[model samples]
Target: MPTFTALTTLADGEKARALAESMEEMDPTPDGVGVFEMEDGSGLWEVGGYFTEAPDEVALSLLAAAYGARPFAVSELPDTDWVAKVRRELVPVQAGRFFVYGSHDADKVPEDCVPLLIEAAMAFGTGHHGTTLGCLRALDRLMNAGIEARNVADIGCGTAVLAMAAAHVWPRPVLASDIDPVAVEVAEANAAVNGLSEKVICVEAAGFDHPTLAAAAPFDLVFANILKGPLIDLAPSMAESTAKGGHVILSGLLVEQAEEVIAVYSAAGYSLAHREDIVDWSTLTMRRE
Candidate 1:
């Protein structure tokens, strides 16, 4: 059955409470319908879900009339039988000497990663995204040069998937950070799932400028898969934290934006070593001078 969800937000809690009283529950035809809200100190936001085969036109009109500013999204729940079909067709990726498994093939990851399912959620890094694959390929190329490190860090570590991949290949202590706490939890879980929790440290931090990160300075390698604006902003800090012969892998920029990001690092004593492009985003690898 198709499900409809309407999102609403009130500038204040009083409006939220008042609006809640107006919701209807008469001709309910599905498993259930409900309202969910979360308050983040900024304001209260709610999503009202209605599960009905027939459109609740009258009720919807009433809510729309009272609160026309509310937005809605409609989505259908997929059948369980199609899970395999969906997985196979939507996600398959390979980069460098690594094969990331988010594929529909139940066992998409090769024997080496046989233990890791590589379940592809909406998480940040799956190596399925072009940027992530670009990073992987860059890492593999670096590997060919007999690169190994005692310390590594991944910035904007969404889901920490790449960090996990790194831990699997190298025994180094990997530092992973994200500003989002939810992402920190997910990354930690992913590391543990892949038996890398002990080797990877997940923290809620932003930028390479933090005191703790600065104290741990001069990592052998750093992986940052964030967009150009921030990359440009943090170039000096990132370069400063890199060991003299270490490298920085950067992503989250369009092919056109690479030069701008590269210019920032290059000006700070880093030399460009490699570049990878997928779709519109490009990833660049640089070695500190």
Candidate 2:
């Protein structure tokens, strides 16, 4: 069974979303449709759809033109075991004392390093992306600096990797939450696989909205590895949820967007303590004032 994909970009997010919705009505309707803002600071939104059969290119072109977007680029993707391929290609990643790898790479885990097992099927926060890796490194640095957090929360935790990392270093239970239920499920599964199921609690919540998160307020350390817009929107809530003098680790921002994010966090009474740029992404560690 072959899969097909059609992708296009536009400057307007609303238009991109509308286009994605419209793609559902097309012949050979897409199995999935997604609209997301480009994280490159380009102010563009990408609209994409996955189809079981080849999509009509002429219809896609017409739809793109209607929305004033770039012509849709359609591609046929041959059926392949993507999870197996990811397992083979994604080697273990070492960020400070934390080592992230899949079970296939179990032999590569070092004796002295803290190991986090994230399977290739759940690939979002497998320490392969710069944002996740940056957060782990930031946590490692904080630990090295004699900062021990009693309560920690991993906001927008994709695979609970950050939460597990925090639990590994600290004795307290860590809270991990994601807006998507599937991610929360994946996070819980990852926690169990890493043998930190009791230490890391996975919940489905938008930001700090759940009862579990509310009861665990004033976190000593918080990790928000989501994109720029959500990070900005989360500043006030994050500040309110964090304890005074607590630490916040943020990533999923472009180098150019870091200063704006810093300014927002500063207004929320946070000062940048450290910043690292890994390729095009910028990660910042801040202390709440």
Candidate 3:
């Protein structure tokens, strides 16, 4: 069966959400509708829907016009085994001391590296993306510097790879949280796959809001590989959650956005210790004063 997708973008989030809500009433209703803020600092929101049957272009055009959005770009997507395609295309990624691979590539893991098994699926962060890779390398750098953390948290953890990495090195229970329930589920599953289920606890929460995260406050280290806006919003909570002289490794930022993020964290009493630029993304390591 073929699937169809209709996408449009608008400047206003409220308008975008309204369009997404209205999509539910259309003929040949969408199987799923989503409204998301674009991460490029453009302040635009994207409204998209997936349909089992081809969506009505007239309806989409009318909705776009009503919302002052760009004309919907509708596309037909052939039914393909995306997971299988991902497995074939995603080779093992080595970042510092961490070796991330899917089960299919298990034979490639080196004896000296810390192996993290993350299947290529719906969740993000498999250590292939520069953001995830940079965080792993930053963690490795801390380990190499003789820094030992007994308590750790991975906020916005996608696959819990970083949390597992910390657990692998320190043998301590690490808290991993994500706003998306699916990501949290994936994180927990990945932890189990990596045999770090006991060492890494997964939770679904936005930033540090959950009771699990709050109870485990003043963490010795925290890894947040989320974007600049959330990273900035998380500065105060991160500062409060981190122990004095504790470390925080952050990524999911464009190279140009790093300075603003650095400034925010600096104002929150953190000093930049190290920075790595992997392609267009920048990863930062900072210490709480």
lDDT by residue (8-96, candidate 2, tens digit) is 99999889999998899999899999999987668899999999998999899999999999999899998899998898888999999
Please, what are the lDDT tens digits per residue for candidate 1 over residues 27-63?
Answer: 5443444443442334355645555464455665565
Query: Model 3 over residues 1-289: C-alpha lDDT tens digits?
Result: 8999999999998888899999999999999999887878788999999999999999999999998999999999989988999999889999988999988898999999999888877436888899999999999999999999999999999889999999999977999999988889888899887888888999999999999999989998999999888899999999999999999999999998999999999999999999999999999999999
> What value of lDDT does candidate 2 attain over all alpha carbons?
0.94
RMSD of 3: 1.5
Candidate 3 lDDT trough over 10 residues, lowest sum: 118-127
Error of 1 at 247 (Å): 0.2
The TM-score of candidate 2 is: 0.96
User: RMSD for each model, in Å, please?
Assistant: 7.7, 1.4, 1.5
The list of candidate 3 runs beyond 4 A from truth reads none
What TM-score, over all chains together, does every model reach? Answer: 0.69, 0.96, 0.95
lDDT pick, better of 2 and 3: 2
Candidate 1 local Cα displacement, residue 95, angstroms: 1.4
A best-first ranking of the candidates according to their TM-score comes to: 2, 3, 1
What lDDT score belongs to each candidate, Candidate 1 first? 0.71, 0.94, 0.92
The number of the candidate with the highest lDDT is 2
Candidate 2: where are CA atoms >4 Å away? none
